[model samples]
Target: MADLWVGNVDDNTSDDEIREFLIKYGFPSFDEIERYSGTGTRPAVMLIFHDTTPDALRGLQSRIHNMFWKDRTIVVQVMPERDES
Candidate 1:
């Protein structure tokens, strides 16, 4: 299993904003950015892919989240990272 880190950030958050943020720091591609619009879609989020066997992404999850937006807790999920490989 790998990981997919996301951010259900505030509504003001934009795809460009998230994309730039991800790339600027040290995340994967933003080409696959997707949007989920529900009644409560105020806070925007990103879908990141991490492909590490033992999930080195766990540490990255909290670290990246905390590093950039200390105010907001970026959301994360550990799963079978996409088979782009």
Candidate 2:
């Protein structure tokens, strides 16, 4: 499993918009996406993918980082795996 953190999302950006943008831009269908509640200045989202490999996830991250969305520069990163102990 891989999760992508998309930062600097606009406060007005909706969940559907993010999903549609990714689909429109050639991203494979994902499992889930969540938009964190914003504090006016800093908003973010997480795109979860369970069907993709690490290399594919990294490629998507590279393609999305520094890209413009809703007029804001988006920062995308592959979230580190968590320990299950």
Largest TM-score belongs to which candidate?
2
Tens-digit per-residue lDDT, 1-85, candidate 2? 7788889988688777888888777777678888886776778888888877657778767677899777889988888864548
lDDT of 2 at 29: 69
Candidate 2 overall lDDT versus native: 0.79
- Which window of 10 residues has the lowest lDDT sum in candidate 2? 53-62
- TM for candidate 1 is 0.52
In candidate 1, what residue range of length 10 has the lowest lDDT sum?
Answer: 45-54
Pairs that collide in candidate 2 are none
Q: Give me candidate 2's TM-score against the actual structure.
A: 0.80
1-85 per-residue lDDT for model 1 (tens digits): 3445465566667767776776666655544445554466435454644334426655555546544363676666545545666
| True lDDT of residue 29, candidate 1 | 51
Q: Give residue 59's error in model 2 in angstroms.
A: 1.3
